[model samples]
Target: MAANFGELFLTILLIVCLTVSSQGREMMEKKYPYLRLASSFSSAKARGYDYIIVGGGTAGCPLAATLSEKYRVLVLERGGSPHGNLNVSYLQNFHISLADTSPKSPSQAFISTDGVINARARVLGGGTCINAGFYSRASPSFVMAKGWNLELVNESYPWVEKQIVQFPELAPWQVALKNGLLEAGVSPFNGYTFDHIYGTKIGGTIFDKNGFRHTAADLLAAGNPKNLRVLLHATVQKIIFNTRSPRPYAVGVLFKDENGRRHKAFLHAGRHSEIILSSGAIGSPQLLLLSGIGPKQDLQRLRVPLVVNNEFVGKGMSDNPMNTIFIPTKGHVEQSLIQSVGITKMGSFIEASNGFGQSSDSIHWHHGISSAEIGQLSTIPPKLRTLEAAQRYAKTKHEIPREAFQGGFILEKIDGPLSRGHLQLINTDIDTNPNITFNYFKHPRDLRRCVYGIRTIEKIINTNQFSNLAEDDSYTINMLLNMSVKANVNFIPKHTNDTVSLEQFCRDTVITIWHYHGGCHVGKVVDRDYRVLGASRLRVVDGSTFATSPGTNPQATVMMMGRYMGLKMLRERLGRRAGV
Candidate 1:
């Protein structure tokens, strides 16, 4: 009896020890709340979500993170995850990401019908995954102009900044660029703040100390993972609508997985359940048009079944047109993206990137300049049509020496461009890239502003501060300007002082900074609450709904819109419940 009792006691002790050890192991193993998938997300069908967000880019990621705190959320991204993509996570690969042409690459390269070459992100983080990583708050004037609740917008800025924003330790090249801007009278030197001000300011960046980029995807860390489901490579084809009632309601979305397998994700039958289109300027409008929610004439032309006659769906497309000035340095400069910005009173923003534009052979400079045949477009006046004709005549005769170090400054017209462009459907196919026409420099004021920007960059390079780093002389400037022009055609430099030549130069050299916005303007396509006009349970939370371009790098503003909209939706739900 004593031996049996002792054996029983030993067995019980071993079981207790094993149970405690197992519990400790479980505690140490961290399981993220969100379920991430590359394909086969059919489980989304079984469990309907409270919120279904399309295009898991900049705006969608943060919005999902915030909304998931209270509601079940699904983010369907058309591209792959940026988590392990070096081209997306590293600051040095900034241009390389944009230059990537692989079909599966996150950055989808496209040329506008007007002949401008640019790229839009197809990744989970959207533009933040591919952009220069510059971060800044929208100007107060912009917030007020949009009639946004300033208090709410202010509250939302910190939520995004805390996760991704970082003050860059100025690289040597950025430091030199800052001095040059100040010497050239950019003024006031707003140090380290994210405020959008007219001066030489060192703004925030997304790149961290180790040079790893912290994108909008990081914001998901603050979310309830169990409430959020992020499906990557899930391309949304169209929004499924129920027109049984007078007002058409977006009930769900039809998206395709990586294997081109179709999947349907539906919003729960809850009172506040909604489908938000945060697919960005181009993607949002394109998706809307594809779903037959655009101009009646356009929808009829494409033989799409009409859902709404909102003519403003794909109109009012505006992008910040940039004119770049490249400078070749004798000594090597540390490679950096946008760090210091020269916000000029002249209605243009001047910013520089180091170690880019080093190779004339790179796609950003070579193919970008050559393939853009803006001359064929009818938007240009007959007089300046010679500028387009010049594209065929211009040729890049002298390539910059491979050993020569190079840096360049970009002049962005951000105050408010007078010219407005449009995006139209080429077909009903969701996979096909839309026809984008950025009628650049259609207005005379836009042309004058770009010319002023180029001259201002010239002044900065000529300043004593940049003299040691830049080639200063009319000959050098003219040669560099001609090189940019000739990349489009084989034209010779003529009448360098004449306004016609300068205007021609502006027309030929201008490219998109990719701050495109306003295909779904607030007063036109969507209400102030960002809900689509003449529709129910649908909203646009990306740059697509901007009234006008905010005069800065727009990533911060786009994220703020997502945050602001997410909170506003929550408030609206509460108000409804209270019968307010």
Candidate 2:
């Protein structure tokens, strides 16, 4: 009887302990629901989701979270999670991620065929994981031009801001940048607002008070965990379509796991099931072309099976062109990213950052000069080539040593570029990077705008507030501009005011601001509702859907679009259920 009682008591105690522990686990799960991995989940087929979102990125993360509120949503990310990545978590390590070329690194660095070096995030948080965490709302003009519902856009902005956006604790360098911008006549300080006003304004950032970055992945905390499944390192290869129906419907997607094992997740046969491609500007269009949804001729050339004959899928690509002016300081400047922006009336935007430690590896002398330009210069007098090569070598040799603390301002042409580019597949293989040509400065106006942008930066640096920080007593505004211009051989000139020389300089020195957009633009590739034209239940919700690039850093606009689309889809689903 004693032994029986002891055993019974022990069993009862074990049950009680488990009950408490289980409750604890439930609480933890709710707190960090995004910690769950795709590998831990059951087979995709067994857990059919109402929505399967490809590219667990800036748009995809928020869209999944919003949809999961009432529907089962699965997010398939091509890269690993950003939850614990120090390179992603810390504000100072911003450029380290951009320069990282590792296969597993969240930032995937790629050089364009046009000889421009840039990066895009492969991690779950998308570009938000690797980019300088500047945040701002889309210009009201941009919203109205795109025909988006203004009220819905306004409502969606707070949904993202409440979770991740914060006003930056401006570092000393950022303060100087702001004062300099105001002094340079980029006036009307709007002060601490997310609105994209045309003036010097202190905007929002994803970095918090502790100097840690809060990414789009953090927005996942708002999701219904029981209904959401996030898969990391899950690269989607193709969109599976049901052609048996009169109109081809995106029924499922075939993706590869981290181990390279293939898996497919299909939509549940519910009233409204969808597969959204928020895979960014490049990835979204690339995936579509691979799935036989692009121009008929291009697909036929690659021998890909025809699914849709959309000629506009991989066209109309645009990226903001950046011209950087490096003002290397002798004193230690506090490390900072974009905080204050100078919006010029001349259709350019100037932004500054400090602590770019060795991140300019992508913008070296040898690599800066395009092969075409090099060839064009090969026939020139060896004297000019030697002088050019020597100048380039000298700049790198000087800058490389100071990369650890050397910080400067970047001036970007946010507007005035009329030229557009295209992205085409090298083959049907998903692993191969697409052929992207921005055709930057193909238009004369773009060159003029770039020159104007450079002149604007010259003015800013000449500001008494900014010039006081400069180390060289002899460094004049023209000298600094000339130094920047000489970085690219094609831009080198006999004199500063030579319009032809400056125009050539603009052509050669232009690089992407990493704000690539369009290719799957509204009215061309997708409709205003974000549904792919001529395809059912297929949609794109990333920057690719933008008719044109927003006049600011596009992170906020991208997130708002995700929130807007997710809510729209939900309303549609509810409406369908009610037989409305």
Candidate 3:
């Protein structure tokens, strides 16, 4: 696995196109002068640090910076560049930020191991570097529902806003998006707004004063303490344990360089090291599995020793259903500035145009109902399911007129019918990317709801308000209607007129976000206190540690978790929050 990854990221040069810059080379060279060629892994094998967090992403970034004020901290992100090369700052710049083919929303745009490709940033700040900068207010009740005191979290949020996630002003963008929809009769209001305080149609992202992407990496750049050191393009491959006692204790991490060369980072738990896995949901789980801390059968099959036999190790994996709706706007909206959530445009209905050819970052508007079936715990869906779905959608026949593409179109894909997937180690090497397969849209009803989502969008768009955009010529609507009837025959997606079955559309746009969860859930790996259930010296703090599924976004949630866990760590370390 180590050897494979070394070759994989050797070039380390992303071949994406952000804008029509005549000279991208000059731009890259000027911006990321610290870029490294694929070389042997450089090692930092010191025997001590106060805290050593693996997978420095959403959670890790904040935790590392904050904790470093009082303790020595080390952050290891498996991907490249910590400061976030200018290219990775904005998502629309994805063409330049990530060269990987896996699209963020739809499954049709990828091949095997494509789920990983759908994600971004192996750099210092993790997903924040590649995310579409949408900030959600923490759901107070939701946090309280998890048995946590929402007050403490609530208290921390404003401080977090000032220092970390800069929730943006959205009225202008909202007004712009909504006013157009209203003029066209597609929306009730002049712009979008949120109902719930936290759920207020989502606000935009935290861009810097100068308008560059404000990522965790950027936050780290400004206020981070000198003690927090970030190791980029580095992967932590193993947890070396002190097995002198019955309960094994973690002592150090084994890492591999880009050349596949192995090195041991000696972290003495008390004097120098406390390990935290902040690699978001996917990366954290894979790190554990690779470290001999997963299911017995998987360990046996892989010829790896089993140090801990936790049945729910990689189970309960989850992510939100992200359905997309693309509406042709009256004017251009900032393609990159993120207005995360907006209400259903008044009369603007959603229609699943399960078409094959389209870009992924188009609008992701509208939510779908999630239906879950807890099949036998062993009935997890395989990678093959997604592959088959993609194949089926790709080989379709359709001829919808161009006029139909003028308005908004919904691409409903994922929802809670969680036929889950798991993380397994290909080998015991930190350099390897996990073998991840999001068995997306595994439930038939889940598929139906996705199609329904699109239909809803179409209905909203065709509202009386949008009558202005409707074609007066019966020829266009009739042609579109005939095409819809024919298109609905075999699979879901695009059908003509306002009268197509959503069931068919479900068969069209099913995809995954590659953000799987539940590998080290509270009940399994960690107890209610977040201490690794059976071990005293080990703990998990990333998204992998989430106990149950939260219905909305998880980036800020992940960061909050890190802050929570860090506070706990701070208390424990000092013997209280202002601990000794």
Q: What is the model-wide C-alpha lDDT for candidate 2?
A: 0.75
1-580 in candidate 1: lDDT tens per residue? 9999999999999999999967643542244346455365765455888999998888998899888877899998888767767767876556556656677888886667767666788988899898878898888888888888888898899989988898999987688778888888889889888999989899899999788998887777777787888887888999999988899999899988888888888888775788999899899999999887999998999898999998888899887787655555556576677788888777888887655332234433322112222122122332344433434333422353332234444344545787888999888888788988878889998888877777777777777767787553543655655544434322222443577887887776666677888799988899888888888889888999875677478999888878877777777666536321
lDDT of 3 by residue, 200-294 (tens): 14453555544466656554543235566666556677777776789877777887655555666656447425677776666677767777788
What TM value does model 1 have? 0.84
Error of 1 at 328 (Å): 1.8
Per residue, candidate 2 scores C-alpha lDDT tens digits across 1-580 of: 9999999999999999999968865664677775444554456345667999999899998898989888888898889878767878987566566645679989775555565666778898898888778998878788888787787788899999998998999987789888988888889999998988888999999999887999998888888888888888888999999988889989889888777788778887763788999999999999999987989998999899899899999898887777655555657677677888988777788887655332233532222112111121221222243434534544454443332234454455657367788999998777677988777777777777777777777777778887678667665656544544443322223344777766665665666668888889888899878889888988889998775677578899888888888887887768646321
Tell me the spans in candidate 2 whose CA falls farther than 4 Å from its real position. 1-31, 34-45, 356-407, 474-496, 575-580
True-structure lDDT of candidate 1: 0.75
TM-score of each model, in listed order: 0.84, 0.84, 0.71
The TM-score of candidate 2 is 0.84
